[model samples]
Target: MIAKPLAKIRCLKSAQCLDETTEDQIDFEVDFVFPLTEFDLQFVGCEVINFTRKIIERSQPTPKQLIGLAHALHALECLPAITPGISVEYGLQLRKGDDEFAEFKYWSVSINEESFEVTSGGSVYDSSVGSDSYSGFKLYVEAGSYGYRECSDDSYGWIESTVEVLNLGGVLEVSDDSGRGCIKGTDE
Candidate 1:
């Protein structure tokens, strides 16, 4: 039998804009809502915070003059624990000379009368040329444990095996299946 759809799912957007003529700078802000249902907010929130910090640290150098900006980007207080049927919002800001960008990570959770499924996916962007980028997904709660599958593009990247979890008593298993490919093109 097919599972029933969620009772309610909604997303809202919030934005702010600022233009400073004296400093010749402009700021634009927008809200990113993560639609999560039937998942632990604390578990996901911890991972999100850690992931955001890693991305920021790897993408840019610590700005001595912009300590506040750095702190704001890694603020964990912005995210609050959420209950089912509610969406959590995060603010994204863009300003001049900041080429740094955080790719939006997507997640979905489904719960039927008996079993549940959770999946999350996102791609990492490397600003520098010749660097590798990774895209992958993770599945939680297989036999009470978690498993994941990932793919990488570009040279010097390692291939990974696929992991699958069956709903029968949360048994976890891994397959030897693996593959890798690199896109060949000129940098325009």
Candidate 2:
């Protein structure tokens, strides 16, 4: 499942673009400060304030959350001029179990910026279908002549990152590191 931005957070705040009519500098910074507690985040709500003074819904966030948000926002800030119709794409190679020898299946692809959040508990797969199954999720950013072969299955295995936008370029390959079922693509 895709991670939801802190919608319940009430104290945290951020600043980014000045206006929708104006361009957002990639260098623009977004910051947040929230109380740290183990239980409040799980049961209570958190808040987020943006640059436009817009108070957005944010859930209890961790330090990792801040880092992920910063990375995604920074990448999107550095957009260059492109053809009007050009699009960005993302992909993932996912499988069950920690060991490479374990049963492996499923792949996920997305172009929506919201699909790159890195939070956990998004239901990457149906736990009931397979017991003792583990899966790893990866994010890819691609652009230009570089793209993955079109896939017909949108019912992908899982999505690992939701807050971070992917950069779609260079190579799109995934390996178990054990040399099992490694997939790679090179842009001509």
Candidate 3:
């Protein structure tokens, strides 16, 4: 049987990125680490802190910022079997925000045998109302040395390519559908 939803977090207004062609685009890379300590699943009642780094890019005429939202369930999926009685699952989404600048909002739910509750954007979810729910965070990235690039020989135009990993630590070299190259993360 599917385990009951225990704790979840979600980002509603998360990230944004604007692309301008006039600036000098350089190739660069960055690594985002989600250590086990951040999940804090060792304790049943402790609050898990959800967070993401921000990225900004400057160019003539227009500037862009990248942002996104994520959710997780059965958190145990990413952890080693050393810990017992802990589980989580998660998902994420990235899109444009409602405002001109990037904005972010989040929700969380914690469960114990006695009750099931949800907290989102400083408001508590009404248990009486039947609705779908989930959990996660947000991330933003802007052009650095490794920003968006046009595919050398394709009609696909521009592609933003990068590698992202959760839990395991390693070096990943990747390319976009348009064949633009990107190297992300680091070995640890």
User: Which one is best on TM-score?
Assistant: 2
List the RMSD of every prediction in angstroms. Answer: 20.6, 16.7, 22.0
By lDDT, the candidates rank as 1, 2, 3
What does candidate 2's lDDT look like per residue over 76-109, in tens digits?
3322111111122222222444432333333322
lDDT of each: 0.25, 0.23, 0.19
Model 3 clashing-pair count: 32
**Candidate 2 or 1, higher lDDT:** 1
**TM per candidate:** 0.22, 0.22, 0.15
In TM-score terms, candidate 1 sits at: 0.22
Ranking by TM-score: 2, 1, 3
Show where candidate 3 strays beyond 4 Å: 1-84, 89-95, 98-100, 112-117, 122-188
- Over 4 Å off, model 2: 1-56, 77-141, 149-188
lDDT of 3 by residue, 137-166 (tens): 222111122322111222111111111221
lDDT for 26 (candidate 1): 16
Residue 170, candidate 2: alpha-carbon lDDT:
16
lDDT of each residue in 102-135, candidate 1, tens digit only: 3433333322211223344444444664333334
